[model samples]
Target: MLNDFLSHLFPRVVLRRNLAFSYTFCLGGLAFGAFLLLLLSGMLLLFYYQAAPDKAYASILFLESSVWGGGYLRSLHRLCSHTLLVLLMLHTLRVVLTGAYQKPRHLNWVIGCLLMLLCVFEAYTGYLLPMDQLALWATQTGMELLAIFPCGPLLRGILVPDGIGQSMSLLRFYALHIMLVPLSVMGLSFLHFYRIRKNKGVLPYL
Candidate 1:
């Protein structure tokens, strides 16, 4: 039954030479793998994380210093998040260079672009959750940079209500980083993969 469903979603030709499975150098699969790693590690970290401004940093410290494997999990999460960005960019460049975005694949290309942006946003939100000096200043600087845009104030308000370093702001970032953004990314990833199959898989190797 599962095989039939998958076969219905993906043509046999596409499945036979799946880009995700066959391409040795392509980083799309690696990006997806990294995302999965981030998801698992992030979930584990959540058990020990505190979203309040006062406790956030201290909790992280405890997690690292005391909790078994917590430090490694956090490191893995951070590493995968960074690695996913690089791999996604490389995969996108490969697609563009191969003219894979042409014709029926245009929608999937657009979806991929949105996924990349969401990945960046996910990373940014998580960055602020650590609530340390670096996270605080980095988030503040990011908001300040956003202020350069026409609707920067509105965007900043939406992202960091009550301003940076505040409890509410930390909570907002936590919600987005852990729940909303990840869910949206997962949904888009499903659509992106489905579209790839619908489009009869990736472009031929260039």
Candidate 2:
């Protein structure tokens, strides 16, 4: 039954020891799995997180010291986030090396690029939520770097509104981290995978 279903979904050649399919280390699958893990761990963290600047740091401390498994959950989320970024870069490099960005798959390539940007932004916003001295300085540095661009001031204004470590800024970052960015990543990932399957899977060798 599984064989029949797979045969319908993939070409017979793909199932018959094709080097392209078999040789791939399934980096994309690994990245997607890491993303899902991050999502689960993040959701767990959300329950103990406070979005306001005043309470954010204290909330994290409480989670780490008081809540059961909180430290482990937070560590898992952090690890998965870093792993996802590395996996994404490797996956993109592999696609480029294989010339998988050619005509039929070009659109998916663009979508993948967008997904990468969103993932980075999501991580950045999450970085600010801890509200510790490190997070504060790191976020400030990021804002300063953004301000170097032509529209940096304007962009920073839109992002922080009042300033870093302020209530509005913390709330905005939290919302983008947990809501907007994740939703966009999910939508783009769906499109990216759909296009790959539609293009007959991972652009066979050469």
Candidate 3:
């Protein structure tokens, strides 16, 4: 029924028989489902989440202790982020093991990889918003790890001009987490979906 509706809207759209439930495991679909949950919960979080360094942790505490269901909402967001990353990895692995990354599907494979990276980056940005001890130490450690990369210092400077756990860094992470990264992910996801739809289905093994 869902395929029929999509086919009605896009007459050329097709799903080959090989796209059976067992073969695909619907990993991509599950990842998108997790993304949708994260998007919704994160948006709801924005209503009460203060990005200021001084109030960041306080805001989280307030939400958890005061707002009904706020803690559960935050937990859901965190869980979905992890779930999406895991699902992406599984999806990528499945593609590799099945040779789905060959020929015309290579572009979509790259998009999938980019989506995974974007999701990881999104998690990193969100990890620091709480401004707690663990967040500070973890972010500082991540920056150190990043510093070892080529042009790492330059990139780190751009990401955290005032240093990790500082006001400026908090604001930067907040902006990237809430706006930039999400927009990039959404745009790339659209491209990925379009490519898949255009290609119709995984091509027969050459």
Candidate 4:
């Protein structure tokens, strides 16, 4: 009467033969590690980051200038975000080169692509949260470019229900940056890992 799939799904181990670092170069694991660091640093930042367009920049300035080690935390967050991007790209490339995307592994490949896209969007949405001039203008230009595409205006509306730098827009971005995107990434990561285990990815188990 219940799924219990997770119980059956987990508890399986990867083959020792597949454990060679050269097989994957650990890019995926490194990417996941960077993602975990981002989560930690980002959570700490939440206490200091103001979400409103009016107060956001000031709050970040205060965090950097006044809060002890706050600048370092922000820097670490930024570094991890960039590192995660690079690691994901390299990991995807390695997967393609290794033919991991063939046959039963294709679904995992799609999931991975979604993960990369989510990370990118998470960065894009977070960029405007501080409400700084450079980010504001850059994101505005990006949005404008997006509008040039078919259905782009509709997508933009969903992303920013009000004007750019407006309260609603900032809040929406804040929500997505802190909550929705992270949760979605974590959820998909679980599924991705499960699929890897199920498919005996990289090498056969047992």
Candidate 5:
């Protein structure tokens, strides 16, 4: 039924794939699967976390020290996030080098670009979730870089909450890490993959 709908909407959908599997899907699938793993780990962490300052850090400690498999889950989440960033970058470069950005596939090109940006955002926000010294310094650096914009105040208003303590930033980061960035990336990913099917798959050179 899904195939039929796709065929009606995009005649090239059926033509997109060769009788053999696509190499692109292999790479994309790995990145997407890693993203799912990160999400799952994050959700499990959420069950044990409290957003408040005193408890938030304590919760992570508890996860590491007391909870079985907690350390492994945390490490897995970090690794997957890093892997997703690398894979997405490689995937984008592969698409671009193959001339996949031309003609009817230009929209997909734009979607791919947005996904890359979102991936970076996702990584930056997620780095702050652990609330460690490294995370704090990294977030501070990120904020400084963001403030370099001519519209620094406006950007700060959105990215930083005024008068609140350190936890506010962590909460903000966690929200974007878990929610906004994922939604945007996931939506654009659907558009990007759909375009691949619509355009009869990646270009031969691509």
Candidate 6:
């Protein structure tokens, strides 16, 4: 039904292509698959995570020391998140250097920029999850930096509300790490690649 409707609306857009034999899938396709793996592993980790003072740290310790295959899952999640950041940066630079950001592709570039920021935001939020003294102090420093701005007061209400306190801040970070940032990045990624295909552009290999 959806395909019929799309065909009816844009009869000549040529939605179907014989991509099964194409090598183009090897690059972008694998990156997207990795992103999905990262998301799933991240969600699994979230289920066992705690955000409190002792509970959060102890939970991670339990995962590392006792839970079966817990260390591997945690390592996979961390590694993929870091890998995604690197791949995304390389993809962005490829587009820029290839002049794909010029003219009609400018909006795609904007979407790519947002996606990059979302990756960074996801990492920043996830860093505080371990709840170690280092994570706590680092988060504190970040909050203080935010507090330096006039908008900081408003952000503080959202970041660490009075009612929920420190745990609330943890919840907010978790939401951003697992939900908000990932969703935004995924959406922008779709737009970015769709535009790339529409432009019939190949990024030059360095």
Best TM-score among the predictions, by candidate number: 3
Model 5 residue runs over 4 Å out of place are 1-25, 163-165
Q: What is the C-alpha lDDT profile of model 2 across 1-206, one tens digit per residue? A: 34433343354554344445554467777898899999899999989998988899999999999999999999999999999999999989988887878887888889999989999999999999999999999999999999999999999999999999899999999999999999999777777766766676456631
lDDT of each: 0.83, 0.85, 0.86, 0.85, 0.74, 0.72
lDDT of 4 by residue, 38-137 (tens): 9999999999998887789999999999999999999999999999999999999988998888887899899999999999999898889878998899
Could you give me the TM-score of model 3 versus the true structure?
0.90
Q: Which pairs of residues clash in candidate 5, taking residues 3 or more apart in a chain or in different chains? A: 98-206
TM, every model: 0.88, 0.89, 0.90, 0.89, 0.84, 0.77
Tell me how far candidate 1 lies from the true structure as C-alpha RMSD in angstroms.
Answer: 3.4
Backbone clashes (count) for model 1: 0
lDDT of 3 by residue, 1-206 (tens): 34533442356634565445576787877898898899999999999999998899999999999999999999999999999999999999999999888888899888889999999999999999988999999999999999999999999999999989888889999999999999999777777777776676555511
Model 3: CA > 4 A from native: 1-20, 201-206
Off by more than 4 A, model 4: 1-19, 201-206
How would you order the candidates by TM-score, starting with the best? 3, 4, 2, 1, 5, 6
Clash count, one per candidate? 0, 0, 0, 0, 1, 0
Worst 10 residues of 6 by lDDT: 1-10
RMSD score of candidate 6 (Å)? 5.7
Which residues of candidate 1, in runs, are more than 4 Å off?
Answer: 1-24
Please state every model's RMSD to the true fold in angstroms. 3.4, 4.2, 3.7, 3.2, 4.0, 5.7
Cα deviation of 124, candidate 2, in Å: 0.5
Angstrom error of the Cα, residue 107, model 6: value is 0.5
Which window of ten consecutive residues has the lowest lDDT sum in model 1? 1-10
lDDT, residue 71, model 3: 95
Candidate 4 accuracy as TM-score: 0.89
